[model samples]
Target: MIGNGTAVEINARKGIFFEVFLVFLKLGLTSFGGPVAHLGYFRSEIVEKRKWLSESNYADIVALCQFLPGPASSQVGIAIGMSRGEWRGALAAWTAFTLPSARALYLFAQAMAAASGGSSGGWLHGLKVAAVAVVALAILGMARTLTPDRIRASVAAMAMVAAFVLPSAWGQIGGIVLGALFGMTFLKGDMPSAAAALPLAISRRVGAVLLFTFFALLLGLPLIAAMLKSRDLALFDTFYRVGALVFGGGHVVLPLLKAEVVPHFVSENDFLTGYGAAEAVPGPLFTFAAYIGSAVGGWKAAVVCTVAIFLSSFLIVLSALPFWNDLRNHPSARAALNGANAAVVGLLLAAFYDPVWSAGITNRTDFALRIAASLLLFCWKTPPWLVVMLCGVAGQVFM
Candidate 1:
């Protein structure tokens, strides 16, 4: 009851739409520290400052988007826009939210590659450490919040173990299957209250489909061509695949990405470094692909890679909403979501071992640092932006 059709408190001023655009654009420009920061920023600006959505509505939307794939903040931004104006407002919301950060990443990738003198070293190391720490914290926070019931927690525990032990693709697929089975078998419950309450219109479903199809073409055609000839698979393949497979949230994308891109070229060091830089930026962490792309190719590669990742992520986010909405609508599917949510813990656990813990936790001193870092994020509530910057500088200076 605050802005547009049926919703009633404010007038739909042209000025307000422009203001919304500028506001999120600024957030996109200044927002760094990954999804947690993005959500925090959204709460501070939209809910607290702008008073766009009531706190209950905001929490409901956040929970809904978390269950859906792609970027939760991005979806929340689109939903906020729709609540205010309409379809064009949604478009404007995504554009302003995404473009500035995408541009920043492209340029940043170019700069990093140039600064590193061809190989990614220097700041990249610190960035990787920061990324691993941040993601680990995220998985922990999400698990605590999402999985409450005993049956759901058990499912999540299994998912976490499977994600940790199974090969990345196999483990993720296995987790999803396990979640579905758990939902179908046990964990009976009512549908989440928020699922049936969404305000989207039927017409906008077409927009979602179009966006989904665009990325499908971008991803599917390349693989098909790879069969005919040695089609050059670049950043597109990894990011596109990462976008498609990642079901839970931004943190879920990390391990899948680690598997996809790390094996192709460079070392784990370079991979994590890019991830850190992505964390330090705004929008979505998937834009980490730009750094990888640029490192692999050049500015052209960075541009293409940035577009590919963004489009891939955008489409997946759009396509999954309906299914997610439907899934949350049922007791059985809701149970499954709960189970799947738990598995995220296992996935993070696995990631900690192989990539984060394995790489960063070398000696007792390093292990202590990591623990300190986690506490800084979780207990001290240190902002990730400041943490990442300090870490990058520290890695440059000492580690």
Candidate 2:
């Protein structure tokens, strides 16, 4: 009964979904260097190579995801998938991208549960150091392309200073908001018209329903769990809230997860061990939830917790995409996005200095090693996975 146009759209959507799944599955296996570096990889693969979206559109997506309270890079991927094939594409992207790391961490958690201790080796430190180099290169590349004008450059610099001074989630949020405001005032002149809007499968009505569900669970889950006194429900509620509320994802989720899980459900040692192991993996740091869950209640609990943590985030994105598709076409929205994009560069730069650089670069020898890794990545154009392997081996041998 479907018209030819409708049937063609359906077929195209299915094709796009499969394509997105394969691409992200490949990335999930190989994309290293944490969330910031994942953004870089996405830029290279989706924006530069595949030409799925323009550089400006990609940056706009990054800025929007950064503004949201979830895994920024993963959320960006979801948005990319949504643009390509709507809600189904978003789910495919998330699944393909998240599955490899989630499975690895889950298996690791099971192994650690069987063993006495978890992995805490010099090689792990090397992976963290490699993350530093990767983020540094990303900052350099994004700054060059995103902050071309002095006005935008100033916005980035100011955002960096704000993030450095505050050094928290709120600071990052403030920086992005300030950038949008600054862009509206200073960067607004002669702005180009917005790009053509992408098609989304979900309607505004459906998006609204999903959004309402997101808030309903956020507010109602705790009350219901309290009434029932169910520990399982409580656990899901806690992680779901964490996914819903935290900004500056990846490492930023650490403190929140620690506060919620440690000493109450799992030991501090186990939690820290899992966190360290998460660094060596190649996908979103949120997968640490699986490890923590396994330590607490085995594989079933691991699946439960991982799904709980990621679900709210997916819901929020699905809810927002339909609306964002329209809002992004407005001139003021485009201007604000320009400022937000510059701020994203600054945010990554600050992240590089604090957690990435400060944590990884401890000594002159570490400094030299990181510099070498940076050269391999930026100048020599080495593969990231290879660089990660080499640096990890070097860390095991030297450090």
Model 1 sits at a Cα RMSD from the real structure of 5.3
- Model 1 error, position 355 (Å): 1.1
Q: What is the per-residue lDDT of model 2 for residues 104-152, given as tens digits with 9 covering 90 to 100?
A: 8889888866655554567656776777776667677767866999999
Worst 10 residues of 1 by lDDT: 1-10
Candidate maximizing lDDT: 2
Instruction: Provide the lDDT at 275 for model 2.
Output: 64
The reply for model 2, stretches above 4 Å from the true place, is 1-93, 109-119, 189-199, 214-305
- Cα deviation at 264, candidate 1, in Å, is 1.6
Cα misplacement distance, residue 37 of candidate 2 (Å): 9.6
- Candidate 2 at 46: error in angstroms? 10
